[model samples]
Target: MLDSETKATETPEDHADELRLWLRLLTCTTLIEGEVRGRLRERFDVTLPRFDLMAQLDKAPDGMTLSDVSKRMMVSNGNVTGLVERLVESGHLDRRTSETDRRVQVIRLTKLGRAEFRRMASEHETWIADLFADLTPKDVRELMRLLAKTKASAQKSAARRRP
Candidate 1:
């Protein structure tokens, strides 16, 4: 049987260790994301993108403009606009033109939206805890530290590539 680090088609002999590590990281992320998506749908009847958008708004109590939400969520404005439209239609979000700029639309969670998000967030925290239950506190801390370094390295590489 192949070990977790080894694939039948690509062994350590055929690929660099770094390539294997990247694949391992991607697989882990995909698996965890799929699980979380299923749980959010089953428990809250909400899609992950919708939940994610709400999460962004939850952080900004005063609310966020569509462009700001798009940037923060790392998505296109069109995607954010669609999410906002659905959320507003469901009465979970309030939309209004900015007082300072009529062309800028800002959105905030309604009372019901905040309340529901809080409830979902509380349970989501527990779900995350359960998902990582196998990792010890020290392991979690070490992974976090290493991932921070990895992020910094990636950002530096990206900066070098950008014009």
Candidate 2:
């Protein structure tokens, strides 16, 4: 009795389970991310993007090029530039032209920035631990195993879709 459009819009019973699982995963991710964002803003007065940038720099003691940071953060150079400007202005980061390549700008966290990041990271770990407190060790391990498989499957699908 349904029209073509109506039938197309409807999910058959076979696909319902996959759709529900996807929704549940998305919901959990959103909830956790929201809580982390709020906690970071309230406790550190810092945004997630800035925290992520600093975390990347923390791993690279020597510093990283603007392009490299942009790639690692999976954002545009402009975004990284703005964050770099603010952090430099706040004395939390140091930026300089690469001696070998004048056109390249390398950035690294300053002593102040490193200290602040370490402090924030320590607290952030605790917050994450608290968030997963309900999960038992076995549950955590199982989730990790399943998520790894999921990630591989997703990556394969993405590669197939790419030109």
Candidate 3:
């Protein structure tokens, strides 16, 4: 009774559950990410990339090379260099030459940076919790399990795609 073009434009109800599930996941992730980005900008005057860089340093107290940071963050070296320079000027991070490799530069968060990052991280967690407040504990657990499976599958697919 319906033309092909009209059928294609129909709602997810007309399609497979997988299509609906993927759309829901994408929408939820986008909504949450946008909220977090806005909050960070409004409250901290910081960008997501800077926050993520600080988070990486938080995990490694000693410090990591500029190259290491680039690899871990999956960003370009130039990008990491710029962030490191800005944070250093702001007194939130410190950069030093590696003792063993003079050519290598290591970066680490300063005391101020660590404290600030902790505050940001705490608030970020609260925001996420609030966003999912409607979900029951059981629902949360099940969602996490399913997401883990999905992530593993995606990772395998990515690996296969790599040369």
Candidate 4:
């Protein structure tokens, strides 16, 4: 039988509320991402990176280039290339050589790919909502505002530290 055990960690009673909020945020992100990835794999046999790339493209008015995808994903060019290649091979995406710039290849979702992405995105939204179902709509709105504020501050701090 598996034992449901947990190790103890030092409590930050000196700053317990802030510590608890940070821990909760971390735990929620991990659990939500885990469940999101699991659903994608189960339903489409797709990895999260590929799904993320497709999702990003879906939001763009124009399709993305290989370099653009890499930059937006904050991943290495090689990594994006590998994932895009796999997606292309699976017939979920189409690659086109740009007429204005032959060197740039634009990647766009095929009709099938668009359909798949839309369906998955719908389900993903549902999953995230369900995960936070216990929270009221007002609570959710407040949480989003707070999280956005936190993210902005963090980014500002990072910018200041750049050498």
Candidate 5:
């Protein structure tokens, strides 16, 4: 729930270095996501969910089914349906039944949607770069490497938790 300007500033004295590292990673993620959400809303009048759905479609020009989007976005199908409806109404996307399967609703970004996403994506990159401007190239590379390791560890732990 922390905003971009806020972070996990309170830490117990007894916490281990791993705990501190996790908190730092979480704080950075929250800050960046919050900022990106705000910027997308302010500049494009769009919510992060809608923007993210569009991003998925942007990557797959062939389009995706409603359920496919739901899986990819880790959201409910109903959630994606509403966003798809709004985007379609705004003429930013097009939806049609799949040729082979009439039950499947395939969604894709229109030309206008592509252009709009490009604009937002360009600003998004600049915002991220600015946020990390304090980090030197070496620092960035080291962080990237470390984060990759952390990600693998987390994924392994998560897999172990699954039934």
Candidate 6:
């Protein structure tokens, strides 16, 4: 059987609405991701994964492990390891051998990392909010509700495919 993407070439007249929704969603995601990535590079000279890891650490005062970052970021364990190593080398974070479990290494943001994360996090929120600033409160609420439902359905589909 052809994959959904391959079958999408049929351009079924009956599926026009779904096609339009997917195209719009794709365009929106690409635009937002590109803009945010450009802003991060221009403002902080930091990669998204490194910034994301720092953001995760910023939320937890006690810090977390490499596996924790991998789970939260939805990245491979090897990718997390490389990113964490680079951050540690840059003086933005540290990984200490766990005392309770000597086999585990816990990662945390340094003072410099926390300060940088605060600045970036503030700007990130402003940028995201600005994207919807033209919408009224009702519009924003409705969009959030619809998007949440769509997101949940997509997640369920992905989960079903996993095993």
Candidate 4 Cα misplacement greater than 4 A, ranges: 1-20
Q: What lDDT is reached at residue 104 by model 6? A: 86
Judge candidate 3 against the unseen true structure and give its global Cα lDDT, from 0 to 1. Answer: 0.92
Residue-by-residue lDDT tens digits, candidate 6, 109-145: 9999899899999998898888768999999899899
Give the per-residue lDDT of model 5 (tens digit) for 92-141.
99999988988999999999999999998889889989999999999999
Best by lDDT: 2
- Candidate 4: count of backbone clashes, pairs at least 3 residues apart or interchain: 0
How many collisions between residues are there in candidate 6? 0
In terms of lDDT, model 2 sits at 0.93
TM-score of 5: 0.79
Angstrom error of the Cα, residue 97, model 2: value is 1.7
| Worst lDDT 10-window in candidate 4 | 1-10
What RMSD, rounded to one decimal, does every model reach?
Answer: 7.1, 4.8, 6.0, 9.5, 9.3, 5.5
The Cα RMSD in angstroms, rounded to one decimal, for candidate 1 relative to the true structure is 7.1
Error of 3 at 139 (Å): 1.6
Off by over 4 Å in 6: 1-14
Query: Candidate 1 local accuracy as lDDT?
Result: 0.93
Which of the two, 3 or 4, has more TM-score?
Answer: 3
With a 3 Å backbone cut-off (N, CA, C), the pairs that clash in candidate 5 are none
**Span of ten consecutive residues with least summed lDDT in model 1:** 4-13
Look at candidate 1 and tell me the lDDT of residue 81.
87
Write one digit per residue (lDDT tens) for candidate 2, span 94-119.
99999999999999999999999999
Which ten residues in a row are the worst by lDDT in model 3? 7-16
C-alpha lDDT of residue 55 in model 5: 89
Candidate order, TM-score descending:
1, 2, 6, 5, 3, 4
Clashing pairs in 4: none
Better of 2 and 4 by lDDT: 2
